[model samples]
Target: MAVVCSKGDWFVSSCSSTLVSVNLKQTCEPFVFDCAKAEKRPKETEGNNKSSEGGSKEKDSDRILGFAVSSSGKHIALTDDHKRLVLFCTEPTWQCISTRWVVRRGTSLVFTQAEDEVFVADKSGDVYSFSVLEPQKPGELKLGHVSMLLAVALSPDDKYIITADRDEKIRVSFRQAPYNIQAFCLGHREFVSTLLVPTGHPDWLLSGSGDGTMKIWHYETGRRLQSVDVRQHGILQNSDADTEKRFAVSRIISSPDGRHIAVQCEQFPSVQIFLVNSGIESCLNHAETLALPQAPWDMTFDSQNQLWLLLESEDINVLLYRHSEQHWKLCDTETPELKRVTEALQAQANVYKGSVGLESQFKHLYKVTFDNMASYLQKKQERLEQQSKKRAANSSKHNVGGKKCKKESSPVAQSTS
Candidate 1:
């Protein structure tokens, strides 16, 4: 369980998959359990020699593919590779409060703003919503997509759920009463890779596609507002001399203010940010570039509006983009204290059966470190921008004086002649 958040607290699950939880309000110590070497020891209880449910937990029962926390940060909803939906309450401890098998092979999980429930999308092209607690059978919503559902997103108001599929279609559904299928956003000619709802705008939804286009649309009205074709920007020109340029939209994200949109494309060699609503617009507003060694899987913006990008490869690496500084900074994942904690938790996970002790610890540490680094870099970028403006002003003044000297010399030379 690798936990990621705005704050750098991370947890690694028994399966070595990490979930980093950012945006944690407080620091909490974690318990690490190493499943590889862990053994279950049962103690007789008062009820007819019964054992504690916690002690009798099963190891490797679930493998999480994607997970998300509620807006309140009290509830966590996760989707395992087996397409099971599991919700947990994080206040007391990491306990499985509820488990509802929503999809036969679930690929993604998205939570509403209220945190009362989550929407699970499956590989077989089925979507279902289940309550966070109490009620069992989930309300089923059968979706027909040409291919698998690739990405899912919830609106800011949580009134609508937007899903993108491999067939390059986006479906918007109302979350409440009617629970009606609102509209199908059709534009991309290839598989859709990601979907995003710009911060503070509940009405706007953005989609990125393998067709190399980043499209912004009005969720409620199903109107195509704007389309940004990345390949036309000339940033990903094929340098093979004879080979043609091939680019696919890897990820698309909008800034917190909704004033800028960022796009990450395959083989593009960098990330690009575009100024939205600005008259000076380009497909790729080459503000900054990140020469990533691998393809980026996902990107999220924290409260400070800094972008934390993750790569989903065997060797995972997270990078933070400093927009003001126009550079990409790699996250420091090698702190001695963090390393010690991680190692300890990993060892414990190997020793405990059915225990999520190590996963919780890894999640906490990941959240803390990622959040801290994002905040620090955001401030650093602001300072650097200020310094850059100051230098530019001073340079302009120097150039003006040189021009005045040239004018004064011109009059003297003319008079002498």
Candidate 2:
């Protein structure tokens, strides 16, 4: 698992069961604590034994399901497959601040807007909030869903809590009173995998789903403003009957200024960029489509809007892209720490599964195909618009001529009478 801090530092968990912090210069050092040696709650151990008695097995302790860094860059949190939640401090050397066990394995984690609290969503569809300042205290249940919760986010002002579940429902509820649901954004045909509200646009919500589409929603009114068919952009092929089940939108993130949105799939070498504007009709204009050398495992943007991509290849490298001359250009500088980590991971590649492989036999499609299809669709839309305008203009001219004839005939009839 990998997370990028606000200050452009990267906190990545390696196969060695250690979390390493990489600074801007690519220097990497072991984090203060080893996650393997962290103490497990007694209750969690009891639960594990009960599960074993019931013929169920416990998950690997080293598997990290979710990881996140607070927006302020002061706090970092991660949840492992053993149902353990760990928090750490980034400054004055990395230190494990707190470690607790949740009711179930967590799937996602997010910090509240104020940075005072952190929310953890488990596989059982329950959300719990804990005070960041007080690590010893227990967490309180905030909300829940009947289906498993996949993603969660907070409103900019902390007024509402937005959550997406496996049932293709995005629920908006009062932050203070989660039972009082404000609205539901429901249009995806399959499970919703990701949810995001742009940095500046508090009223709008962006969602991606297994249905191979990304939708823009007016969260307050539960109205779907726009739907972008991501499958058309080479994420999936139309000939595949199981398109809905095969491809899913893995991630969607907006730029810090909320001017650009980047989208990615589970196993793909390309990232789709969309330009956000005021008008809903054109909010998802395809600004640029970039193809990378390797399939990207994760991506994030820094304060300066530089796009950072972590590839899943054996050569560990973070590709940086900067907007220049109306296009995203790759920077020439490469980090030495990326190389170090890649080499380390490569040496131990046989000992452990290093977070980079596809389970299914999905053929790799080219980005040029998607670009060509987009261009064709744009031209087809333009042609249809032109034809409609011509027909409207001809109808107006015919109406004018008919009125002129009627006036002439009326004068003739009056003279004859």
Candidate 3:
């Protein structure tokens, strides 16, 4: 629910409808923007989903469902549970630029490489594009799939729009002419949860799914280069049987240089690292796993290529990791920038309830397995028992018939003697 993302000098996250921003390169207090407290802009035309008259108050379900930060760190956009697409400008300072309505709830959002438009993917399997230059304009329908879209991304060159759905399919379509299909990356056995197009690798695309595996792909051709089963690393060990069954790849992020990849499961306490080796035949080598005391809700790489972790803890909510000597070392969270962000979040309105201990989003989404072998064996045993009973009855009938004939013959022999 509470996922964090960063680009350029800004690391922003959303708690329900309210967005929290922390300037990574500056020592300024964090800023919070609540959609409920802001004024709604007038709609240009009536939408299929009715808009409340006079900017009716936000509903209980109006939490920030999806959010994205521009590559330049100058803009941010978030969609709420209220079917609203809200945009913000952070360069001049955190300010609400526009609030518009969507026909359905948004699941994932991203900006194009040019940062001219923000693409929002909804649970209804539709992709809508909203223009940043025209803030008050409604989103135009792009392309759609038959299943609920779990993740959406744009290629580095902004030529392709990639989308993943519950049907375990990754589609690469022309961004402008979405009707023209390019390729399909089809290997996952379960619902896809996240998609990533690494920064330095223009042709490479990475994806994670409920199947507990991550795959490397060439976006244009849909060729799978390598597939890594994260379960092999034992990053999902737990005593709870149910929790283990629900494990899936929740997030996948990579460094700006495309040398390291961090893959995280839904509620696991550890993160898996994979080293991407490029050569004549490039492949992924499992690097290591970093265990934490608590499960992290999200992980992201800033422009500096360092990892920032958002944890579900009371004492501290964020941690920084620096790469040194081929290992990630925990940096002290006492830096002025981090301290200001933490303090500001703690001091802000009592809305810092981390998305922990809530009902998991993947509970019902996990594939259900049936014990077909067990049932098959039981039916075979029953059939054999019935056949044995029939054979025994036939044998007893034959034995009784022979005994009657023998008794009749003995009586005849006695009479003759």
| Highest-TM-score candidate | 3
The list of candidate 1 runs beyond 4 A from truth reads 1-62, 133-139, 142-147, 177-179, 232-235, 238-247, 255-260, 266-269, 278-286, 311-316, 325-417
- Report how far residue 222 has shifted in candidate 1, in Å: 2.2
**Each prediction's TM-score versus the true structure:** 0.62, 0.76, 0.83
lDDT of 1 by residue, 268-303 (tens): 446666665533343234454555555454455554
Superposing all C-alpha atoms, what RMSD in Å does each candidate have to the true structure?
Answer: 23.9, 18.9, 8.5
| Candidate 3 C-alpha lDDT tens digits along 214-294 | 999997999999888887675535444353465689999989888899999877788888887877566678887888888
CA lDDT for candidate 3: 0.82
Off by over 4 Å in 2: 1-18, 25-33, 43-56, 236-245, 333-353, 358-417
Q: Model 3 misses residue 365 by how many Å?
A: 1.9
Instruction: Please give the clash total of every predicted structure, in order.
Output: 62, 0, 1
